[model samples]
Target: MLNRRQLLQNGLLCGGAAALSQFPTGMAFADEATRLYWFGSPARAERTLAVVKLFETANPGIKINSEVGGNDYWSKLTTMIAGGNAPDIYQLAPSRFADYARRNATLPLDEFLGKIIRTDKLMPNALKLGSVDGKIAGIPLAINAFALLYDTAIFEQTGLKPPVETTTWDDFAKLCVELTKAIGKPNLWAVGNCARYSYALEAFLVQRGKRLYLDNGQIGFDIEDAKAWYGYWDSLSKAGGCVSAEIQALDKNQIDSNPMSKRNAAMTIAFSNQLVGYQQLAKNKIALTSLPILEGSGQSGLFYKASLHMAVANNVKNPELAAKFLDFFINDLEAGKALGVERGVPLNLAVRDVVAPTVDEVSKRSIDYISSIADRVGDFPPQVPIGASELEERVYRPIADKLGFGLLSVAEAAQELISQANRILKL
Candidate 1:
């Protein structure tokens, strides 16, 4: 198996050569067709291929190749980058973007922005997610915001109204209780898993006028915010309305397949991109809506986050052509429509509008719902801290699990989380 460093160097050299050869003869070597290697899931492979085919048709000189895998994508990507054989461009997540940015392995797009593509057309906040240290390190391909997915049939059966319009978190809790009491134990949970601790915590912090990380990459929120947030989940779990500790402990896919989709849970939080998956598994129509806001919270503090997908690589034979390919994938309406939302919600405003009419009904509803609430959504939290991504799984999971199980008091769990987070963040 190739090590990470070696894979990266090799990929970089290939991409660099491809970039150079795109220039006029005598300006740069023109021998090799620009190579763009993509790392993606098998589910997205067909869509990726369609998009690449469009790109190739538009720019006939460049050659593109894609490699598809599921579950092991991160491991493979790391190995490829470390081996210096990285793709000309590859997918990246917001949670992990800081690591690549800090290491200088990815190209910064600021130097070539308008020259290659019009950066001005992207939503400002969406554009900002791909940037680090005031440099645009990658181009966002799609945006995804957290939303509530509720079973409309279940709500009608129980005579319970889904929280459609904005409501307070306190009201949210009451609804969970009402739903749970009406449905009975194990058969129906008011809420799904609370095991997505980091995402949950960030949502709380943003709603409360705080953030997980400062723009400069330092820990941003205080212990009080963490305490209030943990307490929120603990209270709900204690009420037996949300998924219990036993259920939250399962891996995400397991939870999604079992309780959430089985209609054991009346509602759950999910990304906008998950509409297709939920539709396939859910027996009832899944209603999409914005996450409940805290009472009296101002709209200025809320904003939906763009999907974490961006392209960056350490090696490329043709940096310019690679950049152009990235730009076209995001900005070209026809190309984006062909790929659809396989990557997430398209980050390009023009592409989103172009494809909006053609998406599935469920997907269109999700997009429309989020767009209606876009003004209320806050900025995306700063790129997750170094080691923060791992810490999310290691530190936050136990606390959430403990609270869900009723084994740890909210106060105790809050205290423990703050101490651990501070130690990890060096705050």
Candidate 2:
């Protein structure tokens, strides 16, 4: 196999400007029909690539070279663009999109909306998530949300009533304690060690009507709010509300590898779309429950968001062809069937309706859960700032781990975390 530089050089030689300038960005490759490079994470690669394969079958002239951007996808992708090897279309998360948009790394897609891409079939709210500065920078890939997934068998066996939208945070914690006691397994617990997880943190903040950071890149919550957030989870850990740290430390970020898949915990927090992944590896039937409401608030921590996106690169050779391919990915009935809810709920209303009956029982459940909470979910938080990703590794992860491990008091940890957010965001 060719090394990365060689492979990248080969890609350029095969489809780069000098050779393919004749056809524009979307047409057939001069060598053997046009090749469009699509870079993204491996999280949803299997199902997404299936659709691309079908697209290739249908359009004999265009070939999509799907590649993994690996960890720190945005950082790596930016370097590639600087080196003049940008992918034609790529996956983007709303969190990092603003910085990319500001830098002009991605194409502004407003013009393609009703033309080559029929995003009019998508939910209005979903489309808004991918916009930056009032221009559509990316297409909403899937409208994802946060939820608590419970194993039905465990709840039945324990005689615990399943948690509902009415369940308070205190009530949920008590239920978790009860489940942990009932199971009595060394690794078994009721919740996930959700520290180091900004997604779950976002849900908690949003439930309180806060964002992680303001649109102007300022810290959004006070130190006291962070304290309460840490206190709640810390109390759960002390009460055996989540799996042992040893078990959680082994998490590989793959659904099958999670300790939850082995039923080590009765309940775990997950994105609504991830329920489909968890179902495959879980021995027991898993069901979605609304995130527990905070006491006296009556508001949920779950935030329905357009978590991921499909974006064409600023340098894509043919914008029209790229837009057409992307439209097919989201709006085509066949593509929708192949992708299902692997990337989260389909954002297109037409595609969602078409794939509803054909998807597996698990994916269908995911769709239904997301649909049921559509109105209950809060607004999408602002796009994370340029330093957000850096904060995760250097600042948030360390402080969160301290909270998770009981190495520091809640007040101390919260103060430190908030201080770090303020410091890094300014840098």
lDDT for each of the candidates?
0.68, 0.74
Deviating ranges (above 4 Å) for candidate 2: 1-46, 57-60, 69-76, 252-257
Cα deviation of 341 in candidate 1 (Å)?
Answer: 2.3
Highest lDDT model number:
2
The residue pairs in collision within model 2 are 25-317, 25-318, 26-318, 28-34, 29-33, 29-34
- Give TM-scores for every candidate, taking all chains together and pairing residue i with residue i: 0.87, 0.87
